[model samples]
Target: MKTAINTAVKTRTLPLAIADFKQITKAGLAFSVVFSSIAGYLLGADQIDLTVLLLLSVGGYFMVGASNAFNQVIEKDLDALMKRTRKRPVPSGRMSVPTALTIASVFTVLGVVTLYVVNPKTAMFGAISIFMYVCMYTPLKTRTPLAVFVGAFPGAIPFMLGWVAATNDFGIEPGTLFMIQFFWQFPHFWAIGWMLDDDYKRAGFKMLPTDKKDTATIIQIIMYTFWMILASVFPVTGLTGTLTLSVPAAVIVFILGLGMLLFAFKLYNNRSNRSARQLMLASVSYITLMQIVYVVDKFL
Candidate 1:
């Protein structure tokens, strides 16, 4: 009788569990990663192959989703410590470990298999991204401030992975895409760290390079934002064969960089979370617009 009841209960919870699973996966983040990958694909492809594009989207979403689900599972205890994450499915007991693990395993197989259909290189990088996110970045979050820097590697891969998917090669063109997103991660995450410093501390995650909102940390943000801006302009320099940008587009890209830098400057001058929040919003706009600019520039 007890076994039958448990099975009936699970049947009822299936839909709810799926809902919680979406939250666990952080669907918005997965979408952003997919969008970036699509931009990379469009920029690299001589002629857009809709089939490959669709496969990239499906595979990228599940791969990122699996990584995020496992991250919640690993950090379930720590997550319950902070208000920001206390209500996550794993932490709040809305979903059981077994259920979350099942989701992760399913996504792992589905994502890798779908990406494999695109190309081995795409599949390999997708799998590596999941491994690094769950195995490397997740653990380092509590131990070292440098985790942010290390996390940047996998964070930057999707943009380049798009190129690899379209071309099945890793070259200067893809490297350029990777570098832009790589440098972009620093200031973006540091700003987020600034806003969530207290919550992060409650969880023992030393996200910011420095524990405090000091001059040094702000300087690092500025320096990385500068580097990101420089990297964004690389294609327009006529150095990259596949990613060359027209002069007009280069000018527009520079302006977008300035827009992001403006907020970075505000953060530096104020040294407050309010400014950090603004910088965070600006960073999102900058990266998204920059990616759109790159794709648009290709045609003109």
Candidate 2:
């Protein structure tokens, strides 16, 4: 009986540890960082180095994971009140605050060190992204709606971080990548805010537009959507120096942007949960498809 009990405890504790890691790291966010890093590598590298690619991937994941872990540490109390986040490890008492902090710090140091091994610029930007995300944006979430904009700064860094990792420099290529993602976040996050406005309010998170459903908020979403579309197509115009896309690739990109715009407009007109959800889905699809298109176009 003692051995059986010990075995059961081990099994349960192991799963819980894994769960805590996932929750703290925010796996979806880590995936995005990895994808953007890969896309950046494809775009920036003249000749791909598989080894550097591997390092960038691992470093990007670690950096994003660290940011997420720190975010949870900072928001543990707020998370406990939100229905959506109540079951998270930090909020659910599955992990202690100090333990979470230690994990976050270790992951952050490891991530930065890994990136520094690739290049100093990559490491610097990675560190900056995490600092802005956890220190500036997370706290701003409760203070003002402008937190979304601040959050976008860090949110958009992963895509550009990839470029820096490949080239060891910051230039127009990374800047364009950053701009595209930077503009994309407004619509993407606002759509999410729209969908979860009620829950956000309950959790005292000012995620929506000015904490109310108003014309200004919708207009801002529309404006950002327009900018996102424009940014998405800019590379095809040969304006971003060597980052230009072929005509066919440009056309495909435009079509993708149009699809996303249509969904954004739908959300604007309806402003319902269904519309917002559709917009969120469209935004996600748009980013993923655009990344794929950019990489494929670069090769072809």
Candidate 3:
């Protein structure tokens, strides 16, 4: 399977390098990252500065794109072995290694500088996210099953970066935001790993906690989903500075978490890719909805 995928990638032709560059950055995925950052910022800001929010969106998106590009460049060979990634810019020869590097460098500088203008802490966190993503998470994908765990750090950063940008401090509020996202990533990534287990195996990737859709992995997913729900409700306790949810909003958050857990339980019973796919979709909805809920709760 891997050989066939590699052969296809080797012989592929490009229609346009520019289009491929977009794929290189995984722009579609970056949208969520930017949105999470914006949502975080909105939740933290007393009075929104349009300029700071705009900068955070632009800088956060580009930094995420740069990280994706670097990951593709480094994993071009391994990526070619996976059907899902075989046609990616670097693997399919649509973009050269040097070209990809140049793109990454430009995005990094622009993203970091723009974010720094918002505040030093914001830029500093941005740099740390990119570094961990490109330097740490990217390489660990094939080395150990724990890569998903490492990747969660960078993935969760956007949720708290906005608070840091607004106050120029990493306090309990941002930490609560970070903790919420940190726990949320487990079931999210595990569902994806379960759904793509075969494709990933072709590329020598082992990102799933159990590396297979087994009983133990299902149990872990359920536990993480529960933990995520618990973390999401912490704001209701008023222990986190400037982070509080009213009883009604807390109920809504609980409902969203339960919605995700229902699908997770479905995966547990079926132990199939279909179940995993549904869980993945539920996870997406949960993240987006919960953010909206949190931000809306703040205003109310």
Candidate 4:
């Protein structure tokens, strides 16, 4: 009977561990990082090595996973109060805090070491990104709305990390990648804030601009969306010099940006949950498609 009970418990807890892993690492977010890193690699490297590419992918995942795990550990208490997050492993007592911390530490160390093997500069930036995200952004989420801006710093680093991994140096090429992603986040996250305004409010998260759904926030989204569109097209214009998209590639990217902008405008005009949700979906599609276009353009 004892052995049977132990087996049952282990079976039940396995799913929780899986769920925890997903929540902590945010596989969706990691996918974006991976894709952007690939874009960086394409832009920076004249010839790609599969081995280096594999290392970069692994190192990127580890860095992002560690940041997410530490985020859960820090936000475990506040997570319980939020409707959208209450059932997470740390909040539900499905995973011990100490165990989570251990996992986070190990992932962080291993991730940095992996990147170091790839290139020291890549490893340094990876460590810095993780530090800013978990140590700074996670804590700032509860305290102020500026956390979003702060978080964008680390969020934008993956694309540049890819460049560094390829070229083993920082320059205008990586700078452009960083700027593009940095501008993209404002609208992306603001739409999320708009969609989950009520839930965030319940958890005392000041994500929305000044906690107001007024013209200011909407205008900010629109402005950032406009800037994102510009930044997305800038590389194609040959203004960035190091990375230039073909004319056909530029046209496709423009259309994608316009599609996302239309949704942003809808959210701004309506300020309804439905509009916000649509913008959120549009934003997701925009980023994914943009990455695809970048890769396709390279090959074509």
The sequence of per-residue lDDT tens digits that candidate 2 reaches over residues 202-282 is: 878998766886667778888898898889888877778778788888788889888988887787788788988998999
- Which prediction has more favorable lDDT, 3 or 4? 3
Task: Give lDDT tens digits, candidate 3, residues 1-300.
Answer: 999988777667344555686798888889999899988999889889999999999999889989998888999999999999999888988789999999898999999999999999999999999999999999899899899899999999999998888889998999999989999999999999998999999999997897777999999999999999999998999898788898899999999999999999999899899999999999999999999999998897
Which regions of candidate 3 fall more than 4 Å away from where they truly are?
1-18
Winning candidate number (TM-score): 2
List, residue by residue over 165-250, the lDDT tens digit for candidate 4. Answer: 99998977788888878988888898889888888888788887667677788888888888888888788777776677788987
For model 1, residues 53-159, the per-residue Cα lDDT tens digits are: 99999999999999998899999999999999998999999889898888888999999999999999999999999999999999999999999988998999999
Q: In order, what lDDT does every prediction score?
A: 0.92, 0.89, 0.91, 0.85
lDDT of 1: 0.92
lDDT score for candidate 2 against the true structure: 0.89
Deviation in Å, model 2, residue 103 alpha carbon: 0.9
Q: Which is the leading candidate under lDDT? A: 1
Our tally of clashes for model 1 stands at 0
Segments of candidate 2 deviating more than 4 angstroms: none
Sort order, TM-score high to low? 2, 4, 1, 3
Error in Å for residue 202 of model 3: 0.8
Task: Give RMSD (Å) of candidate 2 vs. truth.
Answer: 1.0
Which scores greater on TM-score, model 1 or model 4?
4
For all predicted structures, in order, the TM-scores are 0.94, 0.98, 0.94, 0.95
- State the number of backbone clashes in model 3: 0
lDDT of candidate 4 at residue 243, scale 0 to 100: 72
Q: What shift in Å separates residue 250 of candidate 2 from its native position after superposition?
A: 1.3
Please list the residue runs of candidate 1 whose C-alpha ends up more than 4 Å from where it truly belongs after superposition.
Answer: 1-18
